[model samples]
Target: MSNNSNTLLGVLAGTAVGATLGILFAPDKGINTRRKLVDEAVATKESLADSALDLRNTVAATVATNKETLDTKIENLVSDASYKADDVINQLEGKLKELKAKNKKLQKS
Candidate 1:
């Protein structure tokens, strides 16, 4: 599972265990104790839900930032490759023209 899910699960498990322990050891009447447990459980659930949402948003933002960075790197690599290729082609064209002129001079002599 994702980190967010695991974290939320841990939070929920901890809340349940703590609430159970508190209820078991409390001196209050059973009805009041039960009500308190229920209220605390609801609040914990809400808190966990909020935390999960925030984690998801953070993950999404991170992913978007990474993707943009990757795209820019790829673009730069492609542009550099194109420039190198053009330079090589121009050099080859110049060499070919020089060879043709030398061949013509030899034939004339």
Candidate 2:
């Protein structure tokens, strides 16, 4: 179902095919052929382990990059909202001052 399983299955099938062919065609004794098969299996396993590790590292790096980008976007959004809020507050303060001045002038007159 998973990608890893599929890849492993493919690797195993190829190894089996190769081993069968080797046994059929080899001039060496049965014991030597078996030893070679075992060695090949071990090498394949090690290679798969290395590949899995590399995949994990790549996934981790991608996650970290995406998280950093999201954090930066959020920070920018907050900063923009704060700036707009301050602008609105400044405009309102100015209007209030003008209204108060007009009221004082009217009262004195």
Candidate 3:
């Protein structure tokens, strides 16, 4: 299976094993055991939330880095295109001037 599927299955299996172990090992009365389980669940929820936030931050950083790299590439392409355009315009202007001068000489002859 895919990596994501494997990771999800692993998490589910780990959670089930952990919950079973916690319930089996408790020495308190039923009510206290239930309360303890609730507390553990809450703590696990918080830990998962923290992990989700960390993942979000990492994704944001990666996106920012990719955007900067794309912007740099676009800027370089624009600069190169502008330089090429200028060279073409200069060459065309020089050719036009030469043509005009040749025409004038031909007319005079």
Give all TM-scores, in the order shown.
0.79, 0.66, 0.76
Runs of candidate 3 with Cα error greater than 4 angstroms are 1-13, 20-28
Candidate 2 C-alpha lDDT tens digits along 50-71 = 7677777878898999999999
TM-score of model 3 (CA atoms) = 0.76
Off by over 4 Å in 1: 1-16
TM-score of 1: 0.79
For model 2, how many clashes? 0
Report the poorest 10 consecutive residues by lDDT, candidate 3. 1-10
Looking at model 2, the pairs that clash are: none
Q: Against the unseen true structure, what C-alpha lDDT does each candidate score? A: 0.88, 0.84, 0.80
RMSD to truth, every model: 2.9, 4.1, 3.6
Give the poorly placed runs of model 2, Cα more than 4 Å off.
Answer: 1-28, 101-109
What is the lDDT ranking, best to worst? 1, 2, 3
